[model samples]
Target: MRVLLLDNRDSFTRNLEHLLVAAAGADVTISAHPQAADVAAQRWDLVVISPGPGRPCDHPGYGPWIDGGTPLLGVCLGMQILNEHFGGTTEPLPGCVHGRAEPVEFLGRTLRVARYHSLHAATVGSGLEVLARTRSGIVMALRHTERPLLGFQFHPESFLTEDGGSLVHSALCLLGLR
Candidate 1:
């Protein structure tokens, strides 16, 4: 599969890139947070938004890509960006979680996923369905009801997560790429 991996100045982008190749067998191209026009000019089978530090509002120029009808996978802050694009809100997580593993029910199974964030989705946007969440009700996974968009609040490429490759594979299946 042809994939466009958008880097948001995040540290885990390289790990994500490897996972996309090893797990999804994707031909990946890395873009360092390119402008909307640059992204719109390319032809991609999928666009993977990398995790970044800061609130969703901190990263603009993604609205056009999110609304362009292409399949997208957003991680961490990227997920927040997706939520904000659809009118959802983000707030600081009470205790803030970073460099930790949390258990959540995903894809009909219990999985421990790595989390590194201080903010989470406060209210999911319209037409987006919450697929999974932490015990504390933090949105862990979401999918647009009528669009080819998916978001993961945790880092699927982190070593702390079990079966990270499987998670990536499942995401590909969910997005109809597998």
Candidate 2:
């Protein structure tokens, strides 16, 4: 299977590549271009759009990939992009959530996981499904109703969460990535 890891940061890009490759024997490729159009042009079975610290909707070029037919797996900032670009809203979320291992709530229960992000605003678009939620009422996971797009607010590469690796592995299974 083939996957594309798109990100401006080289370190995050490489780490994701390694994770997917190790998880499913996927042929992972990394792209450091900040231009969303360039990343959209590539053909990929799965696109792991890395979370950028900035607002992703600020770029008009990003629309194609998210709305286009690319099966995407969003992480962190990428999750925010999924919300913002698809008719959802993103404002400053209350409190800071930064740690490798933290107890977060989802569906009335706390799940120990790693959280690393500044923004947490969420509301799935018109037809999006929120697959998971955090104790703070933050949407932690989402999926497009008619496509293979998926989003997760946490970083699986961080050593904090107990099943960070498993979370990523589950993403691959959802997309039939292997």
Which candidate leads in TM-score? 1
Per-model TM values vs. the true structure: 0.97, 0.84
The root-mean-square deviation over C-alpha atoms between each candidate and the true structure, in angstroms, is 1.1, 2.8
Per-residue lDDT tens digits for candidate 1, residues 51-99, read: 9988877778888789878899999998899998889999999999999
After superposition, which runs of candidate 1 have C-alpha atoms over 4 Å from their true positions? 36-39
Give the alpha carbon lDDT tens digit for every residue of 80-169 in model 2.
Answer: 777777788776667767765666554344667677766775556777788777755777778778778888887776656665566777
Clashes of each: 0, 3
Model 1 lDDT-worst window of ten: 33-42
Give model 2 RMSD, 1 decimal: 2.8
Query: What is residue 123's positional error in candidate 2, in angstroms?
Result: 2.5
* Regions more than 4 Å wrong, model 2: 34-42, 58-60, 103-111, 176-178
Clashing pairs in 2: 100-160, 105-134, 105-135
